[model samples]
Target: MNPNMTPNLMAVLPTLIIMVTGMVVLIGDSCLKGWKSTKSLSAIVTLIGIAAAGFFALSRITEDSIIVFGGAVVIDSFSNGTALILLATAAFATLLAMTYLENKNLNLGEYYALVLFSTSGSMLMASANDLIVLFIAIEILSVALYVLAGFARTDEKSEESALKYFLLGAFAAGFLLYGIALIYGGTAGAAGNGGTTNLTLISEFLRHTNGVANPMLMAGIALLLVGLGFKAGLVPFHMWTPDVYEGAPTSVTAYMAAGAKIGAFAAIVRVFNAFIPISPYWLIALQVLAVLTMFGGNLLAIVQENVKRMLAYSSIAHAGYLLVGVCAMAGNPRAHDTALGAILFYLFGYMLVTMGSFGILIWLSKRGHDCTTMNDLKGLAKTDPTAAYTMLIFMLSLAGIPLTVGFFGKLQIFNASLMAGQVGIAISMAVASIISVYYYLKVVWTMCFQEPDGNTVEGRATSSFGVNVTVGLSAIGCVLFGILPQTLQFLINASNSIMRP
Candidate 1:
């Protein structure tokens, strides 16, 4: 290796690979004429690219952190681990989409390409060391997702979802960019560095200056939080979540719920942890947001009959749980390991369960029918025992039942919060979780105990080997992680070294 070469290349190698792969896929699709050839080839390429990226990310397991691109990006344990998770998520989602699109005759070559491109953006967001780069990455990811959400443009609901998401996402991006400009202004005037938007420089400036509490800096931080909060789907800014989830294609919804949340949490953790000296002022804001998000999300989920809508609310509630981890880090920067570890564990568990649950939706959406309502699952056990069983495991895991990955995830989060003296937030989380069980179990009951409606009873049932494998793997992961919780703890500890605090 060249002694002058920076290790940051190794950190962002996955994102760079995926970005190149996306362009190749796009070109191939444009040249390839037939649906079967384009779909199969594109899917293969996408999976291979994601796997390659993940492998590259996993290979960099050293203890040191490296900043790349003139300090515009950072490679550390935290980002590398998150990049692996994001790539895996994109790969599995592509697999699910391949089968789903084939069944629905919706396999466009651009779909896989867009997913890879968006995932690359999310990876960049996770690793970004500069505010401008972070904002750009967020827009790249958001734009792709907006298009994907409205992929079924023929459907009015899909079109509506896309429009709403686009408008609100654009609005959020504006706030974020403006916030970056303001923060740049504050730091620039004080440091004579022409408004340095670099996070490390900003941190140094805050440390050396008496203007840490400058009104402009506070305003910028608030705007930045609002922008990120919208993406994370926290309360008071989560209005778009339910409608979008209910309207988007099921596979896309799963990708957004799992992969997007991981990216957002990673950004949140980085922004707060890296700027900890001035974070105390915002800790109170996060505390209040966490409590409200937990209670409000669970309460909304209780009344939703549409399974997708309910899951949307549940996603918000999960954001609240993650926020507790964020709050813990703010209050006790020394406990970075515990806080970040819990967040990652929770994200890992959440991805498995959510993907498994949405896999059932994709599998059931055969012959142009979208089976999204709770009633549609009635008599699922009788018609398709394997899918029902898989969904059951997912439901139980999401409900945080014992011997499931979700249980261990919650345990770690609660432990972290307790250690950080956020007992009230933890207690609220527990209660909300109890309330959530009712709706999650209601699906299980509908699947196992209720009689099938005439339409579903007469409808054909089909299962693809690909869907079966995905669901089976996810269910096994939930059970295995639950049984071997220490494995996750170790991974979390290893990843913690990259966190800024």
Candidate 2:
């Protein structure tokens, strides 16, 4: 609507490339209905598109922040950095899905298309400057995920996962929309223009007035947290995580774990950054949520026998740790840069670790069945040393073992929390990490020490080359970034510059 055509178009180039790629894949797949290589071709196309998008996003790292499309969207260091992470996530998911779909007899061209579409949505979420844009971005992400969850159409569990996610996801969207409406009403007179849903405008209004005293604004913020918290898989709203992660296909689970969290947390950080002025009213609520999510997720994961479900709970715990970084952003303007950089770095590291862990399951899966239980991994070290070692790396990283990216990421967050003077939260996070170590080590112990049962496949060879690549790349990322955190200095710089008031 705003006639800043060139800048606005350039601002959205990466997302545009992704959406176009999805359409191209869809059309190509439809036109090549009888070709045997259609599935592979779709994957190849999707990967190239993601790579191109990443290139464009990387090119924007040094550009000045630009609010485009009448402030509905923005292109900034934060968005550029987030886009790269999302693209990396989509690339890895595509690589894993290549062999995974073939093994499950679910190799459809639509799978890659949906992944591209969903990733485009995630990219938009990271840059969204308006509440309406954020909601649209979320739906674009959620709808594709619902379909991907049920891609294994014949699996009853897959269908149930899809149904539950869709129902719960719709309710979450409702909460988010209602929250936006209330904020719009509460701020109706603040800007002297009826109302505003633009984040920048909201900040401008709040800076001049007392947002905490406005009951409607406070209520809106609470509901908004509920909606975003549900998406981030925080405790009290994390009921769907274990069931959905267990029931979905392994490749889908990996993507859902990484991509969804990246997008949701990016939005959470950005939205809450806008609310920093009135943080006294909401910071306590977030702190409580962080502690609850950290302990609840770890304590529950300790009892899980199913590997996928355990990882699901582990993902929730990691969200709590990320929330600790979010808490650091409040009441301490000086700590904002450290906290934001830590959160971004942590998300990238977690993406690599989580996807690589699940990639092992995809690698071991037999045709038409997923290797899901802890017992399925028993004696894996003897049969597939490569996968076992790779899994070991992911487990150690998840447990925050030294020389892994997870440890450094956690360390940064720990320091950031302390910088904010949240000694209690810092201690709680340390205890939670200790609690998580047991379950992660349990995974490694089962893989290396336990005897193979009758259900364990004998002499299993790596089934998919794509999965091998995914696991290998993820392992390298985990260690490479860990040993040399400076490798991510560009992303850290981006995080440091974001959300400045």
Candidate 3:
């Protein structure tokens, strides 16, 4: 085989496996229609596929980074580790969905298929080395999510959420494509052969030329940031996040919150790493956006009466924290590796915490009705002590309390910011974290101290083996990683070692 034509297939084995598994599930669902065991079988197959993909991804974490498919994709520790996070998230979401789907009369095989396909796209985004591949990967993920958002077609909010996400998502894609076009035109020499859409080549070109001075290249970079920042749920472009997150099913929201953010930030780090040599020109914009996102998300979350909306805003704030790591990556060359490692660590911790928090909501949801309002949690301790305590840990972690994974995740980012000499950003993060505590603890107090009204989810908590397992595992992981933050340090370190072509 031609070296460029075949390259190393092992590098992308995980992504291939995920994509194939999605097809199998989709087909199997259609063939097994009306079978009593079809629903359980779908969930089982989804878990097995995710486990296989995660195994491949974890193994790749220690392998040397290599570019494949003519440099359009790169198999590096960064991509591999991110792939693992995305896969693990999918697995957790699958587990949560098992009973939730059955409760909502949505135990369809297509649901599992969409989850698998979306996960594959997230993996591809992490590995994308070329602009074209990045765009395709994003679309693959977004299209599936748009459908998944409206999976509860009978519900008007679900349908509305899907429509809104699709519209905004389409516009974001346009911005990304336009940015790529401008970048390509700006880089192309008068002879028409020097321009490239490959990130590595773009970096080399910019390093050699005064790329920042070129109007087209500068505009493209700005637009590119706008496009991706929207996906990452940064401030000003985050109007869609709350509505969409609240309207989607709790199970989908859990997956979307973690899986989408991981993919977006992975792409952000890769794209910006290529632009790091010109960090001075772009760092200010990112810093401003980070400050806005943190404050905007936190302040807005404080007054939310609906639990889903509150958590939705919370997700936005977490994105701000992740952006701090991105800023640290660009602000100081010396802090690059540390910042990248911090980001991956933060993503892992946040995924566990977010999934667990949302899992609680799913557990409390009654048949055909979501238990997402603040009222539903009143006096949970008196009725369901196991659930109440699990939620307490989740709330504490989100507040960044001592000895929780959330606290350590923020600490690493804070330290990285200080290392990068971003004192203002560091302080901003601290203040924002403090502000977040009020809302998170309010949740804890509602469950533990308050009296339940006539109507509360605790009075009618749903029991599901799958949801219990998901929440239990998430809480344990949160506490474990918090006490032994160093346990995953080596993996984070390896994951940040992105290779340049």
Candidate 4:
């Protein structure tokens, strides 16, 4: 073995482990013909793989930044922390997928493998230090998700969602690649540094230039923002979110809402932190996007009768809240530690609520039936108290009620924005949060106060033990994290110490 290759392999051990495990799962599925249950085994293997990756990532927590593959990737605390969260989300999503797929007769080995690959791609994207590598990582993730979204090939809505997502995703990738090319050209002409595509080098160049903004660089940054904004489900680029979430399998939707957001935000942090000196230009653009996304998402959510689609709009609104933290980080790079901390905490809380909400939906949906509308949930509390209570916890948390994780998450971002002196934005965020309460509570009212539609069977939630566990864990996590945020605060601080610039 080459001596130099060993160290590089060690640095990327987590990604390698996931990739290899995915291949093994594929092979195992082919070999285990007429097995009792391939879905259960697949979920177990995926969970074990993610746990191993998390362990490996934690082992490197104390190690300084280790650049791999000639600076294409960099392993640091920020990347490691984000990787852990991605793995955790993927693991939970796999469990939920297994239960839901089995119920819907859609269980397949390929689903588990695809989830692992997508998660690995997200981790790679988070750690990537080179523009080309980031683009490649994103494609790996997007391709897997597109296929997953259309896994129910027989469903017309699923097929339509997949097509729309693929076309728009491809278009966004083109813009991102063009932006990279522009940045390369500008750097090559000005500094003669062989058209450096490394983010660190570009940041250093900008810092030394004393605020001399390049038109090419500015254009590149704008395109890059557009691409990332689409992935993060921000407004003007979030048209795909509601349709896709409504059409996709509930389990896949949960994964997208949690894991995808985590990966996108991770990349946003890496890019913004490395290119801090030129953030003023992007800050203004993000400010406008944030406002539009916040108000638009909430307004659209209020009008949505479909629960899944409403949650999609709610996800967009949460992304807007996250952007507030991103804006603060951009405005004062020196204070990015707090902003980063807040973003991580918010994501953790958001993941629990999102997963719980979707899991309950899966529980309520029968094999041939889709429970997408709020009307489907009318009188759910009277029919199935357990699932209804779980959903209530999710809704309350999502609405930022006290004693729920979502409340603390919003508080963190609001405090960060206030610290950054964004008073108007902060106040608008508060008003948006209030607007959000109306729709979220509408679901609660339907469950508790409204009569049953009389067309559907009752007690749909009583049969699934696996879903019960998932929902219970998520609801409990929401309350625990909300009441005692210091645990997450400590983790955030630890993550910040390793990622500080």
TM-score of 1: 0.95
Candidate 1 per-residue C-alpha lDDT over 238-285 given as tens digits, one digit per residue, 9 for 90 to 100: 999999998888888989998888888888887776567777678889
Off by over 4 Å in 1: 1-10, 33-39, 189-191, 209-212, 455-462, 499-501
Q: What is the lDDT of residue 492 in candidate 2?
A: 86
Encode model 2's per-residue lDDT on 363-470: one tens digit a residue. 888875578888788888887787888899999999999999999999999999998999999999999999999999998999899887877745344457788788
Q: Highest TM-score: which candidate?
A: 2
Q: Comparing candidate 2 with candidate 4, which one achieves the higher TM-score?
A: 2
- Once fitted onto the true fold, the runs of candidate 4 whose alpha carbons sit more than 4 angstroms away are 31-39, 189-192, 455-457, 461-465, 497-501
* Candidate 3: tens digits of C-alpha lDDT, residues 301-387: 999999999999999999999999999997555577788888999999999999999999988898967999989899998988888
Clashing pairs in 1: none
What C-alpha lDDT, on a 0 to 100 scale, does residue 469 get in candidate 2? 84
| Sliding window of 10 residues with minimal summed lDDT for model 4 | 455-464
Best by lDDT: 2
lDDT scores of the candidates, listed in order: 0.83, 0.90, 0.88, 0.84
TM-score of 4: 0.96
Q: Residue 264 of candidate 3: its Cα lDDT?
A: 96
Query: Model 4, 1-501: lDDT tens per residue?
Result: 889899889988998999988887888887767543543887788878989998998787656777888888988777787887788788778878876787667788889889999999899988989888888888888899999999888889888888888999888888888888888876663446457788877777787778676888888888888898888999999999999988888889999898888888888888877666777777888889988999999999999989999999999999999988888786554446677888988988998899889988888887788677877899988888877888888999999999999999899888888877778888989999999999999999989888888843375642466667777789999999999998776447545743423
lDDT of 3 at 215: 78
The CA-based lDDT of model 3 is what? 0.88
